[model samples]
Target: MSTPSYALRDSMTMLRRNLKHARRYPSMTISIVAMPILMMLLFVYVLGGALGSGIGLPNGADDRSGYINYLAPGIILMAATSGAVATAVSVCTDMTEGIINRFRTMPISRGSVLTGHVVGSVVQTMVSLTLVIAVALAIGFRPHATPLDWIAAIGLLALLTFALTWLAAAMGLVARTVESASNAPMPLTFLPFLGSAFVPPESMPAGIRWFAEYQPFTPINETVRGLLTGTPIGNSGLAALAWCVGLALAGYGWARIAFRRHAKR
Candidate 1:
């Protein structure tokens, strides 16, 4: 068989292994999925009225529906980040186990192990995002995007998921234990809150507003919001694409190096 064919087969084998783990130990994935949904409900119902009123909605302050429209994009991004954490934990588990050492002794493609975790995590993230979106719709989150807009939104999400999954894989590779791996990706999940996820960055204090606007999550959030609501995306879409590509490349390199170092240790 060709080198590429061998790599593909090995990668698929690892992918199936990861999927089986996800199927058997679904509690972790379910917990990750539940966090974003719970947050959406809390923000939309508990705090939506006060926050919606302040965002200059035409429907006035009582419009939780309008708030949902504004909040859904950010929440979706949050869900993606949250789901990526699972990849970190899964990778960490594999790394600490005897199976990883066994694989290193095999003739299969070395990269396939990480690829499998990344691909499986991206798939899980998409599923979690879908569930979150369904809940958003049920809560009256109306988006005015066209078909192209929807495509763009999904594309951006896929890019974000790919980038984050790679980063999580790197984090997992570096961690000595699953506990550290699980905690390492916690910041990714919390990053959206520091950005414009739950509220407009403009409403924040000056220092926070600057950080919020400058952060990677903010551009991605803005791009999603623009795609979904027909708002002007400006350079945010470009910025988001750049961040995703850059992070994916960086993370891939880092994960490869870390895995090699870990194997040698």
Candidate 2:
């Protein structure tokens, strides 16, 4: 009989293994962190003034500082997404390389193997998020969030990371190749751009505006902005929470089913 304590112990051991693998091949982590940072620099330095003015900021025509505040949350959201690809790739690599089959022959909890990948990916995502936020703070982004607000914002990001990591795990399991896994989560990384990440939904065209208003990232971005920058969340908070919970549950179910099917095969 597998006890909860034994499962936790097994999961932790698997977590250490995944962490070691990450340390051995750090190019993925570097790329994941570098992309958002580059995007931040591009938007803040190159296009900030024009975009800021387009958004109707008071001094946006001349100053890029105001745009940084608006763009910071989205970039952080990007940081959350950037790791999904890495997670999917790593999970798929393990599956294709026959390690998952080897694990099946071991005397460990079945769920612990996936748990390790999910938890390790979440940790990596949070670390990347911290780096992005640090860069944001260094580069003229100023958030006026209170302590509680900061806590809520971090919690939301963690929840988002957890949800996405699980989904990526499922994608990894379903993917037939490592290359396919790498590409599967590309849409997730770009979802924020189509939403209100860079501009308000009002600025987009009719069809895009509808999508930007209704997509999951827009509300999540809005809730983060409200928490960090004092923007009005209104009903977006509830919507964001709903989306996070729904995705997390769906992803968990999907990953479990995929893992079982693969185990049987």
RMSD of each: 1.3, 1.5
lDDT of 1 by residue, 1-265 (tens): 9999999999999999998999999998898899999999999999998889876743333467788888898999999899767998899998888779999899999899999999988988898889988999888888889999989999899989999999999999988889899899899899999998888888899999999999999999999999998778899989999999998998899999999998788
CA lDDT scores, all candidates in order: 0.90, 0.93
lDDT (0-100) at residue 222 of candidate 1? 91
After superposition, candidate 2 runs with Cα above 4 Å error: 58-62
How well does candidate 2 match the true structure, expressed as C-alpha RMSD? 1.5
Q: In angstroms, how far off is 176's CA in candidate 2?
A: 0.6
Query: Which portions of model 1 miss their true places by more than 4 Å?
Result: 57-62
**Winner by lDDT:** 2
Give the per-residue Cα lDDT of candidate 1 at 124.
84
lDDT measured at residue 60 in model 1 versus the true structure, 0 to 100: 39
Candidate 1, residue 252: how far the Cα is off, in Å:
0.7
